[model samples]
Every structure is written in C-alpha cells, then in structure tokens.
Target chain A: MSGKGGVGKSTVTACLADGLTRLGVSTGVLDADLNGPCMARMMGVKDHKPSSQNGAMIAARNAYGVPVMSMDMFLPEDETPLVWEAPSQQGAYTWRSMVEMSALRELLSDTDWGDLDVLLIDLPPGAERFQNLADLLPDLTGAVVVSTASQTAMTVVSRSISMALNIAEVEVVGLVENMSTMVCPECGYKDRVFIGVETVEELARRHGVPYLGAIPFNVGLADFLETGRSYIEMHAEHPAAHAILEVAQRVHFWLKNQSK
Target chain B: MALKSTHGPFDGSMSIVYECPTCSMQTAMLTNRAETQMVRSLGVKIGGRTAPEEPMETLRSNLASGQEVSPERPAPSTGGKCPFTGMVNDAIGAAESEPEKPVWTEGALARIEAIPGYIQPMVKRNVENFALEHGCFEIDEDVMDAVRGRLGI
Candidate 1:
C-alpha cells in the first residue's frame, strides 16, 4: 500500500486476504492502483471481470467468494500499455482519471461488499496516490508501509511513511520488510541475498512504527501465484507462509484491540 | 477562498510547489508538515497490511450518503504581510537541494514496463525526462514520445 512499486504489496495483500478467509472472515480486496491493476492475475482470477448492477459497479468475486476489482480487469488486454501523463490528458481525463476509472468512491459506497469484516484497499505506490486517497477519504483508517532492507528503499520509504503520518495525519499501524532473505529448504541455511532484516526493524523502531515481520525472497510464490492458489493453502508449513500468517494474526488482533 | 491567517504561529498548512524545468514536471504539496507526518503514520498501517476500519469507515460512509465532508471553515485572513520584511515573497523559494546522486534504479524503466497498463508509459516518460535533464542520455522528442507512449503514457 505505502511502499514503492515492485516491493510485493500485492503478494502480502493476497496472503492476508486468504488468511482472513481461512478464518471465516468476510473480506474484499479493492484494487485502487488504477494506473496498473494486476491483483486479478496475482489472485489467480485473471479471467474474472467486474460488472455493473443497478448503476453500481460489481466487484469480481474470486473462487473463495472474495470480491475483487482492479484496473487490470477493465484493461483490454494484459499487454496493452497505459501511456497517459500524470498532469496532462485530453477528453475527460486527468491524473484523476486513474482514480475515477477505479470507481473508488462507488466501489466503497454502492457495492454489496456484503457486511465486510475487512476491506483491503491496495493503493498505488508512493506518497502522491496515498495523499490523494487521504484527500478523497480523510478519516479512513491508518496505513501500512512496506520497505526493503536497502538504505535507498528505507530512505524513500521513510519519507513516504513520514508523509503518511505527518501530512495525511493517519495512524501508522506497522512496517513490513519484504525480500529479507532466502532460506534453503534442503540445507536449513539462511542466505542474506538483499539487505539484512535488522535494518528494517531498526528503522521501524527508530520511527516508532511496529516492526510486523518479514517475507523472505521466495521463488515458490511466483509459481504459487501462477497456479492461482496461495502457498499457505498448499504449504501451510512453508516458513514464508508462516511469517505471513503471523503478521495476519497480529493485524487481525490489532484491529480488534483498536475497536475496543 | 480568502487567504487564511498567514501571520503568527504558522499552522501545518503551508503550500509547497516544485517545478523541474529540465523536464517540465511541477508538483505541489499543499498540506503542512504535521498532516504529512500523520499521513505517513497511517501509511505504516497501510504498508503493514492492516486497515483502519472504525473512523475511516464512518467518514467514507458519510460521504457516500451525500454529506458535505469539508473541514470546519478556515478563519478569514487579515491581509498579513511577511513578518520578516515589508517586501512580500510571492515567488516560491529555491527548490529542495538535489541529492548528491540519482536515487532511481538503473533498471527502473524495465521494471515499470512489467507493471500492468499505462503506468509503465507514465513512469518511463518521467524517467526519460529525468535522464535527459541529468545528461544521462540525449533528448529526442519524436523518438521519446513514441517510446513513452509505448509505456501507455
């Protein structure tokens, strides 16, 4: 949601959605990444398209009945590119076109979303989109920031997280460090392919944000997504899945505590 | 809207505008420092994989019900001048100092392309413009626009 692009926001989102569903909690994954929506493919529901009902946009329901809507669904084809400029466009288009195309307002208001226990909005990367979401819906609950352990990623993400907290005035729930390391299944050896995990936790603690957990760099996830089935469902014992479920439980319980 | 109280303890509502002349990209951050921090804090929750349900849900629902969701009206300005000197500083000051080096990845362009629709085009254009301005590559508009459009720009 609050991380730079390609930092695995969608993967984490999918896992949490699956985790919640596994708990019998009704959930909806709203893709607000209007400029580029790929949740359909990541969720293994690439062919599902959103429909309209009684002037309200209908979200595409996954096999598990989780309602999903994204820009990818409306795109003519996966290969076609979106070339519109950020500040300039013609014929009822603007940077706002991206948000409007997502039908974010309608999706939130009109859809049956059917008494959702949780609705995860997959916001685009960077501060600008999140800032727009802030202006569009100011009092919406807090945000989660994603970061890699690299210093550059941390620096940019720090500014982003600061903007979310300081400029948007939203509560920061926690931090998730993705691409931490890869653990060899056969040898039980942990490899630090990218930056070490400590950097992320240190940054989170320094900024006073909760350090949730890390997702190791796993090639299996790519294969898992291709099959349209979550690794958790198949490899419940996978360390990566275990880490994800840990964060999911913490997130669930944290939300419950916030309500109280 | 009338220029609201510019004098005294500056609230976290100052507007900032940035113009990158080399590539012709200008953006503004209208809200103040405090608000940015708040948003970033909320982003932690967002990035951490949790949703803020109660307050946000209620606010969104109210807007859905056609309620006017504007904040309380700002106070009228007294036409205050800059306390520093009588001469008003109308123009935005110097841009934030450039970082010592580029922060973007070398393969950022290819990475953007892998994303679903139009985003690739959009980000690619910005990157090209950035590269041209910094002298990383030569500028060729006809070729650039075409390449940019390929990204769906």
Candidate 2:
C-alpha cells in the first residue's frame, strides 16, 4: 500500500493483512517505511524479535500467524530513531537514499517468508519511494493506493497512481478511501468528515480503477493504534472494521481473478 | 577490498584505487569533471562522490553547452564518426520519430471491445504498447494473451 504520510497506510496494511488471514488466506507484511517503522507495533508483534536461522531471518508472527518484518524489529528501543553508520557526517544526504534502498533489499532478500499467499508491503510516503520499490521488486503484483477524502491527500495519491500506471508500468489494484466518515460516539450518528470536495469514488472513476471501500473514522481507533491491538478482531462489529473487511474481500476477489 | 586515494599534482583531482575482492584486480578511477558529469547524468553517485546539483539540471547545462552526454555508453565520435556512432544516431532518430501504431486483429479488437467501457481505452493502450515493445506489429489474440501474462492481469 502507498500513500502520503499520516494517511494511515500502516494501519490499513495491518487491518488488511488481518482481514485476509481471517478469510483463510496466508498473508505477510513488510514495513518498508524505514524512517517511520510502525508495522511491528501495529501487527501486535512489537515485543518479538526476528530470529535468524540458516542465514535467513525468521519474521515475527502476529496473532493471526501472519509474518511481519520491519525496521522496528531491529531497533533497540521504541524512542530510538534509525541511523545509518557513515564514514563521515559531511555530505551524507546524497548517499542516504542508497543506504535505505540497500537496507530494504536486504530485508526482502534475507527474510524467510515461507510461501505466503500475499505479502503486503507498507510503503512510506512519496512517489519516488514507490518507484524505488518497483525497481527493487520486479515481480510486484500491483499497488493499492490509500487516501483520505480531503483534496490534499487525493491530489498526492493521484500522482502515485499515475506513477504506478505510467512510469512503473504496474497495475493499480484499487483505491481505498480512509477517514471518509466519523461515527459520533456520544449519539450513534454517522456523518461525513470532509465536505465540499471531490469524493474518493470519483477519483477512482477518473483513474479507471476499483473503489474498494471507505473506512470510517472510529473514535476508539486511536486507542487501538496506541496499544497495537487488532481492531478488526477486537471490534468486528465496528463500522470501521466492517469497512476494512469488505475492502479485503474485494481485494481477495481481484487476486483470485488474476491467478486464473 | 581497500580503497586508496591519491591527490593529482596539477589538476587537484583525486584518484581512487578499487580492488576486486574475488580476483584482487586493482583499477584506478580519477574523480574529474567528466567523470562527475557522467555519474550525474546517470542519476547516481559512486562511492562517496556526490553530485553538486540535480541530475536534470546538470544534463540541461551540458546540453545547453553543446557538451555530448551519453549515460549508457560513451559519447559517439564526432570528428571521425564510427559505425557504432552511426548506429546510435539511427536508434536515437528512430526513438525521436513518431511511434508506429500496431495493427489490431479482429480477434484482439473483439476481446478488447468486450472490456468495460470505462477501462477499454486503458487496456487497449496497454496491450498495444506491450505489443510494440515485443516487436509484434500485428496484434492478435496471442499478443493480447502475452500482454496479460506479462502483466499478470
């Protein structure tokens, strides 16, 4: 999944992986966002460290048995930031991207992902990073773009979809609109959060891709995020969880058709 | 393999020796303006060498100054044009020329027409481009299937 930062790419990835696993599909996740690695926490495997066996790193498994690999697994502590060792502090900016790419390549190649049905990679923000991943993973199936209903998020996400279609020459599986609506906790009322803008369904139509579904803004989602809880498993009846599972079902159908 | 740097006497350019780990073969490369220009044109840096400006900016400056830039291969000979230079020019000319549209067979046209109207144009363009890339000027059902297999769509 690719999108701008703070648009809940990691959250969506976690929920999608969980949802797919619930449907009896073996899935795995790789948090490619090195700078802001959070899938380890989001997948409910933050306490587990990857173990190396036979020169291959064994990924940590979540409650649903979905293997997850992320930079967060390698960090010594939660607050510590990821820093690369360089020969000198001068002019480090130029080669930092190369280092990050090398790190991602190592993570992908060295990890022992044992025959997963789908390995969802939670990508960081920016079209350039997506391009980098396209180069790294030549056999990439497709990209699932996530965006908020706001114009700013949609504008950036549209560029990502274009890059995937035109430059990367990859298929865009579909678009997922997150934070589309909010359910009032005080009174059980659902209302649109962002008003007077082009809807995500229109954006999907404009790009000729499927509008998978919209995830609601749940007030309890913040607590779930903080505690690394499986929101879908915890609150299956919640509107947000139902929306995510529905999107997962559509994605699963798309995958089944492609395999045929 | 260890890398050793030496300072040039006249131009102040740095020369670095790279040793191959497998064969222990040593090669020296001079970090000069031409080398920097070549690296920048390729949108990458070697070792610790950094581009002072954006790659496109450097390429534009080189083009504006009439300096030949060939990132993939060396600049073709200008004073005494070689056969390779002629071939390169021909390829560049072909690329610059209008792209030849591939002819769609009845079967392929029917298959594409069966697609949903909203995505028909996209699928058609993608298939045609795939056909062209594969040197299939006449697109048929086989070509369409090949495109589908290549894209796994």
Best TM-score goes to which candidate?
2
Model 1 lDDT tens row, A1-260: 65577778887888778877776778888777755777777777778654546645567777778887665665556764433212123221322343353346555665656668888888778777788787778777778777778777787788888888888888777888887888887998997756644598898888898888888888878657645665777888888888877777777776778779
lDDT (tens digit, per residue) of candidate 2 on A125-172: 988888899999988998989988888888889898989999998898
Residues B71-121 of candidate 1: C-alpha lDDT, one tens digit per residue: 111121223243221111121111111212334453554455566543443
- Which ten residues in a row are the worst by lDDT in model 1 chain B? B87-96
Best by DockQ: 1
Name the weakest run of 10 consecutive residues (lDDT summed) in model 1 chain A. A85-94
Instruction: For model 1, report the TM-score of its A chain.
Output: 0.88
DockQ of each: 0.03, 0.01
Local error of candidate 2 at residue A230 (angstroms): 3.6
- Pairs that collide in candidate 2 are none
